[model samples]
Target: MAAPSHGLTAPLSGKLKNVNFRIGFVELGKKKKRVFVKCCSSGFNGSGICIEKCENWKFDSRKINHSYRVKVQASSSTMPFASPKSRFVSKQEQFFPRCTPRNSGPQSHDAPPKRDTGIANEKEWGIDMSNENINESGTNEDGSTWYRKSGEDIGENGYRCRWTKMGGQSHDGASEWKEMWWEKSDWTGYKELGVEKSGRNAEGDSWLETWQEVIHQDEWSNLARIERSAQKQAKSGTENAGWYENWSEKYDAKGWTEKGAHKYGRLNEQSWWEKWGEQYDGRGSVLKWTDKWAESELGTKWGDKWEERFFGGIGSRQGETWHASPSSERWSRTWGEEHFGNGKVHKYGKSTTGESWDMVVDEKTYYEAEPHYGWADVVGDSSQLFSIQPRELPPGVYPNIDFGSSMPPDDEPPPNR
Candidate 1:
């Protein structure tokens, strides 16, 4: 026996020997090294068979001192090397040269396939043994990994499946392309239960009904009744007194003084002055004798008082006297006769035929007349007098008066001015 050469071994029968071999410490360079061996046969004329070989045989520090060994046995020459039995096994054992054994173990007949040991069990490794058979749960199109309820099929994409649950819950788990579960036949029952507990349907019907009832009972009825009453009062023309009374109440609450009532009497005086001043042309000078003389002649009546205040004592001494009759015709009056020398006056004169005695005076003369007139009469006359005044006054009186500066050539003056 060749002392069982290392890791290489052979079976014998005077034919090529069947042997197991492993490479060990076959040094190639100072740093680069490898080890390789395989099952082979030794025969005449350098005949050797290689089988079950290691891939990329190399040597490292851990395996550099390791060795390969072989074994063989001599046998009769009647068995040829080409025989199938001789190729596989022999009757005797023999050893090969240049090999040694590192440890004692039964010689392996086959080598494991070359593969990455870490990922050997992965699905991508082309090994069907590692594939998982997952049963999806739920009835949805997405093939997710879960035990599906009965009557369900794994969806084509494996993300979902179609299934039915016990309690009539139809699991159509595709909510926005995602899987979900819900009760099918119990939807109406669920709604009714919700209505019984929360007093509403899923569509919010009872809530809307409650809101509508509130609006009808509280807002709509009250507001409609108030609006109807307001409309009736408006049509009947009875709102004026009520409106004024309410306005008066509001004004009183806000601390607004009554028309002629003021603690200092200043508001009354100011209002009276405003009433009189508004009618007078401030540019014309006052005359001393007119207001007093007119008051005497006119018997201190309300009309005469307003006239006195209006013209600031109208008279001839101030300047010219322009009088406008009720007919709106302008006439230059005898200054002394029509207006007192002070610029205020109440002139009573009949027409040229003395048929009717009518009063004529300037706007200033009217202001002096208001104090003696009844409040109603004064208000009425004031309105009428204001109506007669030229709608467009000189800018000296009202800065904002439009004087047709920007009007087109063909445009007529505004009507009824």
Candidate 2:
């Protein structure tokens, strides 16, 4: 561990300097630079504001992570700032290093020139593999736009390739777009591995929103897993709001599935969060839970939670539910039944005013129809969107290649989880 070192100190002499904040990091074997907004403007003299930011970083040489903190002093004259003099790694970089692009600049259709290429596993497989590349971008007749870039290696046994594509439309000062990427390898009668990513964005007057989902699969059991995230932010006439959420799912052919999701956001003086998930056994059994909580600027708070199990696919139900109100009222219930019968329930309620009640009674419950569980699907296909085989490339259409070494470094960190 190293002591926190100060990176910048503003002089107290009243002279304002345009903020020129720059930081560098070597991520994925490439150096990246970040430039912050120019600060110390006179426009904010009468406005009261404060800002604080903290970033976590991991050095390759150190076993533990480090925290880089920045604080802006809130005052009338100036906003003095303090920050740790160290590099940091983003949550995205920590988790999805390979899935995220190394460069943060606007993605162009141009591919980096090939630096050097060599065949791997040539002796073991006795196959000579050659590199193929492609890069194309153009506007379609429908007024939509599209771009594609890819590279691959083909051998006698199998092939490995990576590609990215983006297409969308813009009109009337509003736009919607989608981008997709894939990296995969397959060997005949052997193993396979791959990752795929899809992202979409929508923007309009005073609002912007985006989401990205990635899927991974391997040959071990042909099991597939999916990860997804989304964020939306908007502002209207002196009020602003933002929300973000992340979720993941894993499943296999053997009838086993698991999923989890969580989300948190803020609106004006209130902030809230909700998370839920369910698991289904191929044999007709399911387990699920939901938790939600919220708070207000005035110190009011409330929350709800539910946990349930359905035996033989809703043939029976057992679960507990809890709710809390901002007025200090609390209510809870629990029930268990086999096939909607032979069940008992316990109920309780309490309030800060010293009122409370509890009771027990016989209970019977059944779903009139199939339950929707908790979370709605972000992308269809039950969360298993990929197969074991890699997508085939077009024939004899290989061109521009960047060879990975020439791509610029990513300026922005991966999105926070």
Question: Can you write out model 1's per-residue Cα lDDT over 243-333, one digit (the tens) per residue?
Answer: 0000000011111111110011011112111111112122333212211111122222111222222244444322233334445455433
- Candidate 2: the clashing residue pairs are 57-89, 102-410, 103-410, 104-410, 112-401, 112-402, 133-399, 284-313
lDDT score, candidate 2: 0.40
1-417: candidate 2 lDDT, tens digit per residue:
344333432322222222223322322322221212233321111011212222322223211244233233234123323322212221111221111122221221111111111111111111111134546665533344445455564554345544444433332213333333444444322222222222222322133333333454423444443444334333333355555555555444444556676776777899889888777665556777788888887767766676677663234334444555666676655544444344645555554446666665676654322224222332253222233354354576342332366333478532210
Worst 10 residues of 1 by lDDT: 207-216
All candidates' TM-scores? 0.12, 0.40
lDDT of 2 at 263: 73
RMSD from true fold, candidate 1: 50.6
TM-score of 2: 0.40
